[model samples]
Target: MLIDAHCHLDFPDFDADREAVIERARAAGVAQFIVPGTTRRRWPAVLSLGARDDVSVCLGLHPYFMEEHAEGDIEALAQALEANPQSVAVGECGIDARFGDTLDAQWRLFDAQLRIAKARKLPVVVHCVRANDPVAKRLRQLDLPAGGLVHAFAGSPEQAGKFLDLGFVVGLGGAVTFDRAKRLQRAVQSLPDDGYVLETDSPDMPLAGHQGERNEPARVAEVCRVVAGLRGQGSEAVAANSTATARRLFRL
Candidate 1:
């Protein structure tokens, strides 16, 4: 069975035919999906999807939507987790330096979530962009839980190593499909199979050949093919290894 370790199926992009999209993924051997919440407002949607047998959910605030987040959202997230023990992880949260000014707020939110995850003894699904150093630094400071996925990882092997040292899995996906993403491809290849997992980040970061198209969980198999090629392994091997890694990380 294959697992798309990180995705946002609760988003409107899948509203038209979400069930069909999931069926397509299952047909392609993508048997499971871990949907991470991007904001407090979306927590209900994410958890509702997770209520299904095939889906697992992670809850937290996303840095990109910093403006919409309230100061009490972190406390609310904690309460939500306490109310619903089914949540497998804490995130879709992290720092994004690309969007200036929100950097500080992002750090504050990220730290809060990290603390929550640590307290709950649950893994975190992190979203990072142009903030690997600081993210790494914070991970070092907090010493996160045993297992987590750094979703859509685009960092140097050295930085990847830092996360791995903290027992976090580096998530590889569509970004590696781009020929110009040499660094990301190298990171994908260099990742130890046990320390990495696959994701599609659906409805965003579509693979190379489908750049302008909407991505879905079904595309994860293609991502496996591309990543396997980069790692000099077969697609089946990539699927199996990533699935095992994800299962271990999320306790799915």
Candidate 2:
């Protein structure tokens, strides 16, 4: 069975038929799901999802929605994680250089979350985009004890190695299935057995042939197959290793 290590099932996109989506995923061999909070306001819903037997959660302020975050949200995150031991990690947090306007603010928020993850001894679920070098540098500086997962990673093999060195596993999803993604495919091939995990980033990163539609956790099985093909391994082995790596990283 596979574990979708990073997905946002709490988002409104799934509200209409959330149960059906999850059931489909389970039917497709996805045994578990990790939903990461993107903002303080959304933590309640994210935490609520975690109460399920198969769901785990993480809390943080996402870089994309800088305006949605407030001054004390970082403190609130720490408090919430303390209050809810069911939370497995501290993220959906990281730098996104796409929004150059808030680069510094993003770094500050990412830094605070990393500190919280360090002190709490929980892994992180990072959403890194176009800022891998700086993100790797910051992670090196803090040296989080529990490590983390770099969600939706599209970096080169060298960059993947850097994150692996820092006790983090790069998340591989729909992007690697495309023929044009030679770089990410190379990274996938070069990754050590435990150096990566499978994720859907549900309702966001739609797979290659399923473009223009909402992505869901069930497609992780296809992702597993694609990854297995890339690595010249069996689909079952890819699923098992990625699932084990996720469980080890998030303690799920």
Best prediction by TM-score: 2
After TM-score superposition, the amount by which residue 236's alpha carbon in candidate 1 deviates from its true location, in angstroms, is 1.2
Give candidate 2's root-mean-square deviation (CA, Å).
0.6
Instruction: Report how far residue 221 has shifted in candidate 1, in Å.
Output: 0.2
Candidate 1 on 47-74: residue-level lDDT in tens?
Answer: 8998899999988999999989997898
lDDT of 1 at 231: 93
Give stretches of model 1 more than 4 Å off: none
Which residue window of length 10 is worst by lDDT in model 2?
Answer: 243-252
Error of 2 at 184 (Å): 0.5
Model 2, residue 137: displacement in angstroms? 0.8
User: What does candidate 2 score on TM?
Assistant: 0.99
CA-lDDT, candidates in order: 0.89, 0.94
